[model samples]
Target chain A: MIKWVDVYKAFGEKKVLDGFTLDVHEGEAVVIIGYSGAGKSVAIKHVVGLLEPDRGTVEVDDNDVPTLPRKELYELRAHIGYVFQFAALFDSMTIGDNVAMGLRKRGEMSESDIAHRVAEALELVDLPDVQHQYPAELSGGMRKRVGIARAVALRPKYILYDEPTTGLDPVTSAVIDELMIRMREKLGVTSVVITHDMRSAYRVGSRIAMLYDGRVRQVGTVEEIQHTKDPIVRQFIEGRATLEGDAASLAAPGPAFESGATARGGGAE
Target chain B: MNVIEATGRWVRFRVEEAGRAGRFLEEAALAFGSVRSWLPNATLQMRRLGVDSLPIGLLIAVFTGIVLALLASYSFTGAVPLYFVGTLVEKTITLELAPVLTGLALAGRVGANIAAELGTMRVTEQVDALETLAYDPDSYLVVPRVVAGTIMFPLIVGVAMIVGLGAGWLASIGLLHLSSDEFLKGARMFFSTFDVEYGLVKAGSFGFAVTLIGCYKGLRARGGAEGVGNAATQAVVYSAVMILVLDAFWAMTWLHGRS
Candidate 1:
């Protein structure tokens, strides 16, 4: 389980996450939906200790992520797979080598065993027989799949997807959404997908959390979020411009939604 | 901003940059503790940095040698002995020209390439991906390039020295009508092993400076394509400037002190 408790983070003077809190239990997909700069990616990054919260705690399986020692942090990271938005494939390396990098670093597997596992992971992603190809040679969707293959090659306990379907076509986005669902069910791994695509959230998420201002505005099942009564949530769900009074309230923001907004929000449960 | 405020900001920026450089050095030192893991990458980088650079180094050395010999001959018309042209060419090429010129040339070639490659990776988040995969970026990305540079720089300089001398000798004998024996004697007259050692030291130091600055600029690159381009340009410019500064330091400290 991952828990972000009263997290506060900022860059220079801009507070990106203020008293932001969320929890993801084991073996479930929780997709965090927010605007482009809403800090959804920042929230998931804390779970893997990629970014430390300035004033709160991020715990994974009860291990304090930010304060963990370097060795322990690496050990923690070994169990968490992070898929970058751009695939982040090493251009110089072949697809096979990219997939095999994590296993190779562990230094316990034989060359043939690593090769076999690379093949298996690629096959799981339905990207068989493209190992020798470089990332530049692959299509954008294929590269994203290769990125997923690389992440799952380690058989991590948790997979963090950062806008996995952002730039892909709708059909390709559906493919990625399906892959996320399949990976969760097939591997029984927890997933935290950070995306603004509501369709993707509905398709792959076991529960959807909407991050607004700085905190989670609402979190519940897809239907529950869709039927939410909160004006902010309703406006966001319908992709409508905020109504006059709603805009005024949201625009006057100095961390407008206070801490514990999640608790008071009816849709949170 | 007021002049004082502007000056304060500049000072702060320099201090922060120095701190970052110090941190980079610390990380690079730690990377050496895991040197065994980076050997394969080091070997590949050595081939790329050293072997591929040889032809270019040789080309520069040969042309500079030929030009030196021709210019020295023009000044040899008076009481100055024609044989002295050989000594002048040999000393300048071996002690200064070969190593410094080769380093400057590579600062543009290899340094820019390293920065551009790593900068692109940074912008694309490949380096972050390495961190996420539990791989140390310093060991995987930096150590190999630095180690390769330190090892290859001296070898490239040695090649440059030999080729430069050979080209000078040929130019002296063929173009200037100087006898082989006279030219050879003049070349060997004032030669000292210390000069070779000085060149090697300079070469190694310049190599490290070029690669480290390149990697530093590349890793720190932000924004996007424009930032990557700027990093590559800065790598070349900084490496060239550092190479010249190191050259002057070596000349003042080592050569002058010894003489």
Candidate 2:
């Protein structure tokens, strides 16, 4: 249903993706796993036509996404829902309005019909009675639920999740994982989840693709990935492993170390 | 902390925002310059700011016409020759009241609106959403405002000129016992093509500055309610300040060119 063929993308002098290609079958749940800045987000952004590949084509339902007219592109996008990281709910709106935004923009549905669908979407995300509340008033976990509800409000055939559980507590993350499983079971919709949370990826992904340095290192079932003894993969899975050689090299980059170590140069509160 | 020191901090933050506003304008102008891809957004922006602003702009013109006449009658009562009242009415309405009042009207109606819309867009990620949707948000959001300002400023100025002239005629005929024909002749006596051209130039420049500053503040709006409030305040402040400065500049150049 989706394909990225020989894609190349760059920002100024830095090449992010070079000749990257991938395919996702119909109704398949594909999870993209990678470390930060590994181009996981960029890859999904291509699938949705949010970012166009410079050299190659992205196809949704066999139609070249970048070449589609504005109306056609919007129509195609209507079938694919997106849940952004940080929820990105409209802070100016109530939860109900946020979910209703997609439907209202279509301008074909009646007010009553939109209201009913919004309620249904919220219910699907296990959120009830929170429609009247603003996004700023909700907990982070609850806001993610609103984001999920809004993404699914259009009854899209596909949904994309970008780092869904990154900022959540462990328990909340587990809850979100369960919800993802139930959504696939209940809706039978195709899902593309970009995540670093291994447990969540395992729970939700029918097939997992591990992206490293802007290319797919491996794509297989959860067992295939988990059991693979590839040293680089295993080391990353072991959580931030550093070989003696890596430590020596990282240590030897003196200016780099000193720059990173400056506490005063770090993020402000 | 002492009260004075706390107030000083507040003042510093305000000063910082003024600096931020200047930076936002520069960035927005640069971003809007990249309209090679997205042209429709500029039109949509026109619909929102310029076309939408017409009704209230007209209302303001009409009211100002009547008020200008009423105020002028008081000042001219027995202080000047009665026959000169008709010409004075025409000159004041044509030369000053029409263009200036129309601008003031827009400052309230269109100015407040662009600020709020842009401010809301700033906080809601709608601006970023536009970028994600592959449309250049600034060009879409701003260029329309500029176009609308250009189109509507002159239109409102025209409306104000006509109504103000008519109101002045009524006042002169009713109060000063001058005939309509006499008043119109004297009003037309001072009406040079140069004066008309100069007023249009002022209107065009004023309108552009108002819309540009208004939209820029909105798109760059931050924080929550406080941020929006600041954008609104700044929109009005910057627009008003720019208007006075530009008016002075135009007046100097116009007089110099004519003389």
Candidate 3:
């Protein structure tokens, strides 16, 4: 389980995360939906120790992420896979090398074992024949799949996706969404998906949490969020442009619970 | 009051930036402990940063040798013997010109390359991906470039030294009216093994500084295209300046005591 407790982070004067909190239990997919600058990516980054919180603790399986030593932190990270917003594939490397990079670095697995795993991962992502190609040769959607293959090759216990469907067309976005679902079903890995795509959220998430003003505006099942009574959550889910008066009110905090180990907020807190 | 406040803030920013760079160096030093992680990459980097840089180094050395020979003969018209031109070329090429000129040239090429590559990776989040995969960015990305620069520079300088001297010797014979024996005699007259050693030392230090500064500037790049551009520019500018600084430092520390 990954737990972010009252996490507060800022870059200079811009407070990207303030009192942000979420809990991702094992064997389930939790999607964090938020506005463009609502700190969705920042919150997920804390999971892999990419960005440290200014105030608060991020714990994974009872280990405090911030306080862990270098060896321990890296050990903790090996069990977690993070798919980047832009795929972030190493352009210099071929697809096979990119997929095999993490396993090769661990130095425990033999070359044949690593190759087998890499081949299996690419096959899982429906990219079986592109191992010899570089990332520059692939399309945006293909590169994203390779990124997923790279992560999945590690066989991590948890996978974090950052805006996995942000830039793709509807068809490509749906393809990535299916890949996410397949990873969950096939690998049984816990997932924390950060995205504002409502369709993706509904499709992939067992629980969807709305982040606004660096806090969870509402957390509920897909059915509940689909028919939420909260004006802010409703406006976001419906993709409605807010009027001035509604915008002012929407900026205010909601009554959702700040954070909890179980479902927190909108009566769950 | 506002001017004073702004000035103070600027100074504080520089101090803090320096502190951060120092800390980055410390981390890079620690990253060297992971030999297996960086060794293969270092060999590849050696080829890219050193062997590939040879043509340019030779090109610059050839022109510089011709110019030094011409200038030496011009200045030695009557007062000094023609052979002193050989002595002057040998000393200047060995002690000052070879390492300093080649380092500055490579600071523009290799330094900018390192900075631009790493900066692109930074903006693209490849470095973050490496970290999430439990690979140390410092070990996987930084140490190879730093190690390549530190080791290959002296070797490149050694070749450049020989090529430059050979060019000068040819110029002394072809352009001036001196024979091979006279030029060779003058060349060997005042030569000490320390001259070559001093040049190699400076070249090695130059290599280390150029790549280190490049890696440092590259990894800290922010934003997008503009950030990468700024990092490449800063890498070139800072490493060029560092080359000159290290040149003077080595000259003062080693040559001043010897003289």
What shift in Å separates residue A74 of candidate 2 from its native position after superposition? 1.1
Error of 3 at B173 (Å): 0.7
Q: Give the Cα-based TM-score of candidate 2 against the true structure.
A: 0.64
Tell me chain A's TM-score in each of the predictions. Answer: 0.89, 0.88, 0.89
* Candidate 3 TM-score to native: 0.94
Off by over 4 Å in 3: A243-269
Q: What is the lDDT of residue B192 in candidate 1?
A: 88
TM-score of chain B of 2: 0.80
Best candidate (score: DockQ) = 3
How well is each residue in B143-191 modelled by candidate 1, as lDDT tens digits?
9999999999999999899899889889988998888888888889888
Tens digit of per-residue lDDT, candidate 3, span B1-259:
9999999999999999999999999999999998988998999999999999999889888888889999998997789998888899899999999999999999999999999999999999999999999989999899999999999999988888899999999998998978999999889999999999999999999999999999999999999999999999999999999999999999888999684
Model 2, B1-259: lDDT tens per residue? Answer: 6999999999999999789867766755666556643354556655766667667656665665556555656677778645555566666655566667677667766777888888887775566544443344555577767767866687667666776677667766776566877777767766777666667778888788888888888887898888988988888888888877887887687666664
List of clashing residue pairs for candidate 3: A257-A265
Top TM-score hit:
3
Residue A101, model 1, lDDT: 93
- Compose the digit string of candidate 2's lDDT tens values, residues A1-269: 88878888997687777777778887788998876787888887887677888888888899898898755887787788888887878776799988887787676799999999999989987897999999999999999888888888887888888998999999989878877777777887888899988888888899988776566767788888888666445544544323212332454576544543442123221
